[model samples]
Target: MNRCYLTARGMTVGYDGVPLIRDIALEIERGEIVALIGPNGSGKSTILKSLARQLRLLGGQVFVDGEELQRLSGGNLARKMAVMLTDRTKPELMTCRDVAAVGRYPYTGRLGLLTDADEAKVDAALAAVQALELRDRDFNAISDGQRQRVLLARAICQEPEIIVLDEPTSYLDIRHKIQLLSILRDMARQGITVILSLHEIDLARKLADRIICVKGDTIARCGAPEEIFDEAAIRELYDLDEGAFDPMFGSVELPRPMGAPRTFVLSACGTGAPVYRALQRSGEPFAAGILYENDVDCRLARRLAAEVVTERPFMPVSDAAFERALALMRGCERIIDAGVEIGETNARMAELIELARQLPGYNTLLN
Candidate 1:
């Protein structure tokens, strides 16, 4: 018995006469949600398009439930897989419900009138995406977010065992993004496999059971998010040298200002995070200190601060660390105290605060 619902073997994909990615082999199990992540122009969409049968596969074998993709009839393919592509195409005069109900065409007999069961599924799909209000409205008249939801509903009503979406959250607001992804999560739990490409690494980290890294004319890597999202992996995958990507938070930070320190900061916990960004935007080289290597503040400071003085987590601030921080603090012309909790382990923070008070220009950014 094979639990593998989708398999790609020796896949070589590209547009006419040229291959962008080659020799790819991967397997996706039933009900698992796999996310494709990579930097721009790395062929994420090209791969999705090939898998969805929208483009010619230069060379490869794609199997859906052990049946070769090319061997499947159009109707058979539709019954097994549903795709929501990146392209936005709308038909004139078709209502949202009419567009959505089209997914049932594979299941409909000749004459194509909507049966009660088909209509019920269509309605349910629309409601699932909270787009039922637009059901009667013209598809071309809806907003991009609404249109995206309708397209998703159309895919849902198809009720295939596998769903592939490419950058589905591009036009959606944060709320709608969460709602759509939650629905996809629910579907995967109910034994439907999902493959999606996301620009939102955070969302991918949260929702995907596995992540595929596409890069440089091949599948760079593929594994669980934990394996693929460490600082080194992300930096290499994205070829990022000027910015920092935090695997823990799935957040990205721009390059810090270069050269000598212009500002000093007193912070701990997560309090220093905003100050880092603020300093970056202001184009001021800065230094931050007395942060634990494992602190949330340290995670960000290491990227945006010219010098970040760090100690091991759970240890008291040592005299050497305090001296280093003080020297760096006095070198700066401005000081910002990002109010943090004063606890036994970080009691030396009080000394930094008094130092901030004595500094010529000092203030608390936030409490």
Candidate 2:
């Protein structure tokens, strides 16, 4: 089993006399990518800063390698851990290589001269981030993504046991985001502890070995990504609106349709189904409308005994089919629009929504 590299025991962090993260208790082990996530102003960054010794702990303690963090000297701490903050400062007349070399300062003697070994490590770090070609370029002149990578290279050059980053992918495009995360994942595999705060929950879900969800100035949950990404856990942690818990996508948004109801459901492709399932389970009368055979929702409608209005294989909808569907919908006491997908062929669903919106008793059941 891997040992814990960092431990927070009853940690309280905040500004002045006010505490933002109270009684926070978490342990980070070696060879793990731990992602800190939550809503804005929920103290995710605050906790990270506090762990990095950038913020004074209001109460409790943080331990690095079984030693009290506050008791560790700056130089000693630098050897044990490195931090990459999101904000960048303009360092005068420094090339990217020069800045990354600064990470070796803790190990250098009074002269602060780089040994041959130090130079080689700096080169390796730059290459690790794919920034070697840009080593001669001015750090201040590079794009935000490049600058961020350079900063990460600096931390990697430190060869610290634990690395902490604050929103490392903040300014990166999708490709750079994936690249940066892949680098971190590789670092964790090499027995380095990697902790970072991120805003993108989906990316966190995909990349992190462990997840810590901060909310209301405290940790709402901490576990494997699979454990924390559940609908109830995420909905409560993020304070999502009702009907936002989506099991399939692990997001709090529109509900997806399971299918048409047994009585009858008049929904089309991409129409969400929680409402349909709810009505079906309640034994309400329902049927499904103008369905294409291959549509997922249509398949569900068929299973539920929803009088399906379907078309032949790969054929355009006929006028007779439209009339039959209209007649079936007319007999229902109420019509529901489940927010169907819109396309050239499916635009008729929007017309149906519009028509329902104008009806005397039509209602919408949004997921």
Candidate 3:
């Protein structure tokens, strides 16, 4: 049996006969959450719209569950797939429940009236998205976040085998974003294939099983999150000449402060992250060190700090690394001890602290 629930072959997509992206091919398995990520206007939405049959494909074809998407009847496709796009069309005098009930149209009788069972599913879907309280409220009167949840409820009530969403987290608060993504994760576990475009690379990294990077007229890269979220890959994918993307944290840092080191930061463990960011925000070129390559601090320092002296993880602070850090420290006007736990393995840290005290303008961050 074919495990791929959705397939796109030679898919060329665009607006008004002009191709924005060309020759796209994808095979998304059942229950996988695939996220499309790229720069704005990179055609992520265009690809999604074409797949959902909202836009006419300039070329190629889409298949859902072994049936060609274009060949499926409207009702047949509605039963198998649900799409939640960004365009919100308001209906007159319709309650949130009424909007969600529209999803039941495919399952309803010829008169298009929802049955009690359909209402129950609508209520359940609303409850799932924590929007049950808005069920009686006018859809047009709700906030964007609330409306997004309600629309998600509408899609959920459709009971699709696959769901396609475009930037679904727009206008949602951080909490709602988490809640919505959690709901999608839950849905995927139940064998619902989820395809969505997300501007939040961090959220995409966390939520997507596979990530498709849409760039410059084609699908540039498509693979597991681990393969797609590398520092170099993300930097190249987004054309990030400024700023740095940390794959480990799924975070982006502002460009490093220009010029020579002004402050020397001594830190270990994860303590240096905030200091690094603070220094970056202040546009202060800083040197940080005696950090292990695997240290969380080291990861960020490499991006924000003008100079970083790193040692291998689980190894004692080496003499060469200490010398390099000491050289950087001597050049800086101020030294900040961002705190470290003194242990037998890194006893050299104590020596560095003692040396820092001899230098002018040395301060400890910890109590």
Candidate 4:
């Protein structure tokens, strides 16, 4: 069996002698990317700091490469693990290359001079993070996304066996977020252990080889993302309402159906799939109106043998189409709007909502 890179047994973490993470047990192996996630103030950061040896454990032990963490010297610990903390304060006038070079300090001589090999490693790290072009730019002058990439480069330059990042993507945009995580995934594949804290559960689910979900200062669930993302587990951990989390898409807030039905569903586009499926499962009768040929929901509606009033490709909503949709709604006990993207041109749908609101016995199920 491969030896674990980091191990914690019966661990309790806290600050100023007050325990926040209680009796936690976890093990990370080489080449694994572990995501630590939880609600705010749930001690995810505290647990990370404890693993990085920034905070003393209130109880239990943390082991790196089979040695107790507390027994390692500062330099020894530095060589074994590199930490990219959440609260990084950039110094004015410092170049990006200068900041990344600091990771070489642990291996440098007393004079703090970078040797030829050190420079090569720094350059390689910058290249790895796609920040080579920003190497000469001032750290404080760069965007948050660029600065985050530089920080990651600095951690890579440390050449440690393990890297711990606290909210590494917090400062990045969508593009940079994907870039940074892709780089981390590549690093993990190269046999380095990677662990990070994340607020974006979807990203965590996609990237993490293992997930450690903390809730109320304890381990709520810890396993593969597939195992942890079940409805019961997510609802319990996040205190979400029933039907709030969609297992297929990992969305927390499901669109609600507004007003009572009279005849059938007049929904088109992908936005209507969830509501259409729900209504079908509930055995409620619905019809489809003014469906576009390419809309997936229209196909589903057709499969369900729903009374469909369809239009030709790229055709305008004719008088016949409008009449058909209106006729369907007239028979519906209620009308439902399932996250249909409304625009100024879609004012008729808004009018439908108003009309439904004025009708007696109309109600919406707020999920």
- List CA RMSD, all candidates: 1.8, 9.4, 1.6, 9.3
Cα RMSD, model 2: 9.4
Alpha carbon deviation, residue 179, candidate 4 (Å): 0.6
User: lDDT by residue for model 1 over 153-269, one digit each (tens)?
Assistant: 999999999999999999999988998899999999999999999999889999999999999999898999998888888899888874478788788888889989988888888
Off by over 4 Å in 2: 243-367
Please, what are the lDDT tens digits per residue for candidate 3 over residues 43-138? 999999999999988999889999999899999999999999989778999999999889888899999988789989999999999999999999
TM-score preference between candidates 1 and 2, better one? 1
Q: What is the TM-score of each candidate against the true structure?
A: 0.95, 0.72, 0.95, 0.76
lDDT of 2 by residue, 301-333 (tens): 554534667766456666776777676667666
Which regions of candidate 4 fall more than 4 Å away from where they truly are? 254-264, 268-328, 331-367
Tens-place lDDT per residue, model 4, 1-367, is 7779889999999999999989999899988999998887888899999999889999998889999999999999899899998887768789999999999989999999999999999999999999999999999999999999999999999998999999999978999999999999999999999989998888888899999999886898899989987867777777766656655456554323333343455455776667677776666666655566666666565545256767665565566767777766677767665544445444455555555556553444434
Model 4 has an lDDT value of 0.80
- The candidates, ranked best first by TM-score, are 3, 1, 4, 2
Tell me model 3's lDDT, rounded to 2 decimals: 0.91
Candidate 1, RMSD to the unseen true structure: 1.8
lDDT of each: 0.90, 0.80, 0.91, 0.80
Clashes of each: 0, 12, 0, 13
- For candidate 3, the C-alpha RMSD (Å) to the true structure equals 1.6
- Please give the RMSD of candidate 4 to the true structure: 9.3
